[model samples]
Target: MSESETTSLEAVDIVRILELLPHRYPFLLVDRIRDIDSDRSCIGIKNVTFNEPQFTGHFPTRPIFPGVLLLEGMAQTAGAICVLASLAKSKKPEQVYFMTIDKAKFRKPVIPGDTVEFHMTKLNQRRNMWWYRGEAKVDGAVVAEAELAAMLVLE
Candidate 1:
């Protein structure tokens, strides 16, 4: 691991996450940000449960977490990092809008009872647009990955 990866990160709990993000329960995918390296990278956490509404219809039997939702979770993780960085610079947290998703791949099915860890790194940023690469892991196994782009809407 490089020095940037090894550097210790401060944890941001659910309360702070909620303040930084505009999502709410049932739609909010991220539980907390486990570690943050400002605008460079961060790790996000989500505990999957059978009670989640998606599981009810995603599959009545042999329920599985939706791949699109996994992608959304990763996007949310990236958003949190940007929001934290903005906050640090004394700028109000702006709403991040998805610009694009590319090279998305699902390697394994995520089910209820699995704890997902979303690891995201900044790939590039120009003006208000940011690009990121992210992976979703369960118990150290990669379940999903994607390259995503977003734009900050300052209002």
Candidate 2:
């Protein structure tokens, strides 16, 4: 929909994230956003499960959520903020896309049944480009964090 139409508590679903982000299954990370303060901040969620593609190679019997993927989820969450921030700046949220990642750090292993919460906040938005800071937490403990960049296109 529109940036003005989105909100917190019940934010974007996987389908909505797919519509807003340039990612998909086997790659798409965030399952949903618990909160989205359009252009400001948002919290994304991912329920780690053994069925995920990464589990196939990330230790077959004992699967753990890949750290990079965790950062990716945070980036995607950051992307959502970037998307909304760009829309606020350019007036069209649909054109935004994630472009870069920086300062990514992973603290612990995330395994099956764990619910990762990705919290992202917009650091800046200059025209089509947006920058954000993100963090991933489980059980209220910091699991990962990063700084990410994204752009908005007219397509």
Candidate 3:
């Protein structure tokens, strides 16, 4: 691959994600992020467990990971990379806001013990706004997909 075509793969653990994002426990959906190619793409990992708070009432009899959280995971995954990319340029944003979700679809129910990978690819970017297409996959099969948009707010 040529120099411009070569992309460095980076991984961000929970600690750094915490610094880049405002989400906390019970809200921080992404456990780790990997294969980060600047702000263009990345894969965020979420390990579903039976002990998560949502399972307590989402469905007492047959617990299932809520689909809305899956979409949030995708947005968080994309938002993280955008912040990371901005930091590389010495620009820090105060907050990253989820702007829109489109073409969202849930293909399967995610349950405990499932390790989900939210694969996100940038679709468009302008100024401080970014649009991404994300796919949440388990065992390499897509469980959910959506197109998400986010805007970075500066101080």
Write model 3 residue lDDT over 3-51, tens digit each, in one string. 2231474788999899989999999999999998888899999999999
Model 2, range 14-56, lDDT digits (tens) per residue? 8777877878788888888866777678889988888877889
* Superior by lDDT: candidate 1 or candidate 2: 1
* TM-score pick, better of 1 and 2: 1
lDDT of 1 by residue, 49-153 (tens): 999999889999899999999999999888877766655555664587878999999999999999999999999988677899999999999999999987777
Which candidate has the top score in TM-score? 3
TM-score of each candidate structure, all chains considered together: 0.91, 0.85, 0.94
TM-score of 3: 0.94
Cα error of candidate 2 at position 26, Å: 1.4
**Model 1: worst 10 consecutive residues (lDDT sum):** 1-10
Off by over 4 Å in 3: 1-9
lDDT of each: 0.85, 0.77, 0.92
Give lDDT: candidate 1, residue 52. Answer: 96
